[model samples]
Target chain A: MKSKPTACFLLTVVLSCVLVAEGNRDVNQEDRTIEWWTLSTGAGEHDPRTDLNRLIAGEFHEQHPHVNIEITPLHVEDFKKRIQIVVQADSPPDLFQSWGGYVMFEFARQNKLRDITYFVNSTLSKLISRESLAVYSYAGKFYGAPYDMGAVVVWYNRKIFEHAGVPVPQTWQDLLYAVRRIKDAGYVPIAMGGKDRWPAHFWWVYLAMRLGGKEAFDTAYGGTGSFTDPAFIQAGRLFKDLVATGPFQEGFENATYDQQAGLMGDGIAAMELMGQWAPSVAKNNATTGKGLPHLDVFPFPSVEGGKGDINDVMGGGNGYIVGKNAPDETLEFLEYFLSEGVQRRLIEDQGIIPVNKAAARGQTGPIATITGLITKATYYQLYYDQYFPFSVGEALNDASLLLLTGEYTPEETAAAINAAWREFK
Target chain B: MENIKTLYSVKKLGLILLLIGPAFALFTTFVVMPVFQGAYYSLFDWKGIGPLNDFVGVKNFVRLFGHEPFRTAIVNNLKVVLFSLLFQLPTAFFFALLIGRQKFPGAIVFRSFYFFPYVLTEIIAGVIWRFIYNPQFGFLTQLSGLIGPEKTEIAMLGNPETAFNAIFVVIFWKYIGFHMILYIAGLQGVPKDLEDAAVIDGASPLEVIWHVIIPSIRNTIMISVFLSVIGSFNVFDIVWAMGQGGPDHSTETLVTYLYNFGYKRFAFGYGSAVAIVIFFLCLVFNVLYQKYIVGDSRS
Candidate 1:
């Protein structure tokens, strides 16, 4: 009977520890824990990226014995849902994954992010590129930095291109001709994941970027111009012309991003407009698990009679942003995470394009080519869906889907986008 | 000693209140309060955070009604409800009539077999159906390819015209067994004497069924219809896993439309407005259903 009370006391102590696991730093002031959340892209629970991140965190902990890192790796959709709640509550993790545009700006505007401008200017300036860092900047203050970066380009199957007997396209007309030829050769000309919406939206983004360039985007985004501008309409018209050829695989409207990658890997589709992550997804989805027999990328072709520069690029990348309640050690961890040593490993094993300038030298093959394309670009436009406010961006996606389906004319599509833009604050 | 009966009744009432207190509190806190809170939040243009200062009354509703996708969602939901009543449940009733007789061989076996679809989770069913509907390598596509002349390709969920109906078929399959089982249970209560009386009175199987078994199982049918109507309004998982209400929102239902355009877009105010509309829809439905259709049975 005496032992019963003692047992209850011990149980209470254990329960308290369990409850305070997430509340560790709150109770003990001396213990600084950096809660880092990153999105795990693959289906597997044990993502290599997360494993590498844990290793890096271990190293960091060794260096700073006073600090600890609690890593929470979530899937893409789960991360999006969780981040919104946490940031809105103003009790976000110390460091979390960020795509670094409208959403980041929204968070920064709400004073949820730590103003790490000084850290960037003093330490990270020498490590990462200006373009990658600029995305995290809201009203002249840096909040984050990217570890991996790449531009959106047409990833094509070289063997399929060889079979179709088409040279690399340099102009809009040339791309159209190549697409027709490829389709006639009994292969899907352009593999589009219409169900996902973003994959189909990229065509419109590239076309708009090619036609209107920075001037059109800036004028429209700044509210000096409107989405119903002739440039946007023209972009829609060109995309419609591409749609006329029925270049996508049968039932493209329901095809998810994974299916698009699968087609390319299975050697059924000629090309796809995708980011650097496309190849990895294709490899996993491939029948043989080796992916495409011969894979290559070329810059999106220039549109004739357009104001845009031919070398202009449109893309975005993965990065991290700090919460307002982040510890000082969070900056140090960011620095180490984006350092040359770690980044080189990322490039070598994961086939990631590093944002670190020193680590860029290690990139070879298609990744190296992408780095070159991005570097020589006179203009780099972020993906419109990410760059614009949440609702307006989603409107663009919805409009783009309608455009590709040929349900709406170019004028109608542009009008739809403008309507949504008008409603946005 | 002066009021013993009253004192005992008061004690019993006190005991009842004490027993019901915790459950009542929980129900009000979680369910009732959220409904009222959602109504209040529906008025403001709140983004799930920051100040609730943006007071935009009735504007969210106006926009929601005018929205094209929301209209599609409403129509799709109505189709689901209509199909459930006119077709799915009727078919289930027919099957129940066939198997409800204990004398029918393999009656339990058929019931178990029919109920198998309901055993699978909504998401698992969706994923399995997605594989069967794949345009390139799907089972249906391959089977059609063997029969058709032009190397037949059928993208059931891929086509906007067919996607909703295609998913509806899967949903119909999933729920048919449930209603059939409900009817079967109701049939057990239907005394054999009345059925025998109808047969002796020169009534055919159809007429006898209409007069006798149908009247006896009226309560079960009402409950089944009510469940089906509510389920149609709230259908999300299968549709979501299948297409996420895509192919231009062709397969969109009310709840899916809310998730896609509301929460996913971070328009919490709009989402709240959607919730309000759905609440009123369900509430009105429940009230009308209880009062008009099955009120007598309750009384």
Candidate 2:
């Protein structure tokens, strides 16, 4: 009888201890763990960006000793596909890398993303540029924050241009003349990666922007106009005219972006229509290990009868979005991650064009020029592949390539895009 | 005895169920369920997320048949099939005959050498071939330079007329060894005494091979053909790793078409419709092949 009573008392004590442990664990788990998914900026195991991200996470965890962050780093290409599946499964990471535009809008529409407007207004709004911030906003609500904003500009090798005896073009006709001069000098005038499709489509999108500006896109996106607008068709026609010049390197249609960058880096091609990252990519892919010593940037020249201003820019930025079930600390973490000091460090280390206003002051060379153009832009248009609905954007890429290959006329290309737009819309 | 028989039968029933239950369940879950689910999704206009509310009803299918890229994809798949049947299989058979029963010097080494490509993963093989086909710094460019000073390079994969053929070359190189191995196995099974008897009875080597060896390997050839046809239609990874179905949708097979148009574009409904179409194509071919070929041979 005495033994039974002793056993019951011991059981009660052990059970209470277990319950208390469980209670503490629940509270700690709720406050502590955060899951983050990101794309590595370089190859696996050797990526410095992955180390930087981990260091940032480590520092943030040190500041808040109760928190633990689990980071999942994936390759750039695989990240896009994996995130989509995870988002669809309703269990997305607390935060993941995003290229802010229609992809974010799609997620926002499905309520897969958390609205961070309050956090943005309180902290991020003052630190980051409104133009850059707008990239992460959808339906009048902010869903994320940007770290890097870059414009697509014409990057040219100064030596190549000098050899060809052609000055930097200020008009479309001048560019065409330079192309011919460069070609005559026995070098590829342009290095185009048509196999990827997006690089080639940039030509059409920039042309469309030059021809019609923001109004045309707005009207078409607003459903009052169609993609078969004269401006879009004319853009295709202009691109075809450029294609007919045979300015791009031989087999350019099958070249990847890396191959295109290699040609420019090796001085085999005189110019490439690329973004701020082009120089770095060229340096990495170049045969000499160091690309062209003297590089220059020029804005896309104005067309003869175009309504759009030459100052209007086409670009995008890399950012991170908060998942629907993310903890409130995710916002705090983002703020810390994009702090002025961190942004400067990123710019100094990684050659990223910082979106932070204070960090933007430190940019030099081609990056500074791109930053200036973006800041002074009368309008900023994101890449069409990211700006429009997925189907329409893909159709634009496909049709644009078809137009380049002489398989489809400008009218037929416009018709294809418009047909896809109608279906998706 | 009757009671014992009933007990044994009950035990047998339990054992059979126990053995087959897991496999049956797995097949139903992974294979059968997805087919039915894909068919169901084909009726709706879903972007692969949220509720499937947009019930368009045969609209995706109607649009798929009318879509230009899809038609191009079908033609490309047929081209692959034709190439494999006409070129790949015959080459594989010829090589198999040369080395199958013969004990030539380096025959073992040659067998391993030919089968080396078959052992490589498709993606790796595709990447290797891509480097070879590259115009700027590729082997072909150097070869062309050596041949002519001005004719510096040839971009076989860049041209629409040649991209699919380039991919076909890789496919043929990768899979011909597998078919050759199959033929070798069939040849090994052919009774050596039958060939000897034929030769002794005044039949020539070619006549003996035609009469004795070919008839014995008919079943293996039939299976290889069926596999090759299905494989041709389903090729995606190689083409994707090389060009992703373009310079301008020039190298698109049905599977790549389904991926680029449906999944990449986020039109899951249309993608599911494409999946159904592919399934039906395979099913029809399988049924026809089995009925006319395998079944006839068996009878």
Best by DockQ: 2
Which runs in model 2 stand beyond 4 Å of their true positions? Answer: A1-30, A89-92
Query: Which lDDT tens digits does candidate 2 get at residues A202-320?
Result: 89889988998888888877889877899999998888888889998878778899999989888889899998889889999898989677888999999988989999999987899
**In candidate 1, which residue pairs get closer than 3 Å at backbone N, Cα or C atoms, i.e. clash?**
none
Each prediction's RMSD over C-alphas, in Å, is 8.0, 5.2
Estimate the TM-score of every prediction: 0.93, 0.93
True contacts kept of 2: 0.73
* Candidate 1 local lDDT, B180-245, one digit each (tens): 999999999999999899899999999988999899999999999999999999999999999999
DockQ score for candidate 2? 0.56
Residue-by-residue lDDT tens digits, candidate 1, A364-404: 77899899887788787888899887888888888899888
Compute the interface RMSD for each candidate structure: 1.2, 1.2
What is candidate 2's CA lDDT for residue B270?
A: 92
Residue-level lDDT of model 2, residues B104-186, one tens digit each, is 89999888988899999999999999999988778889888888865577798999999888989999999999999999888
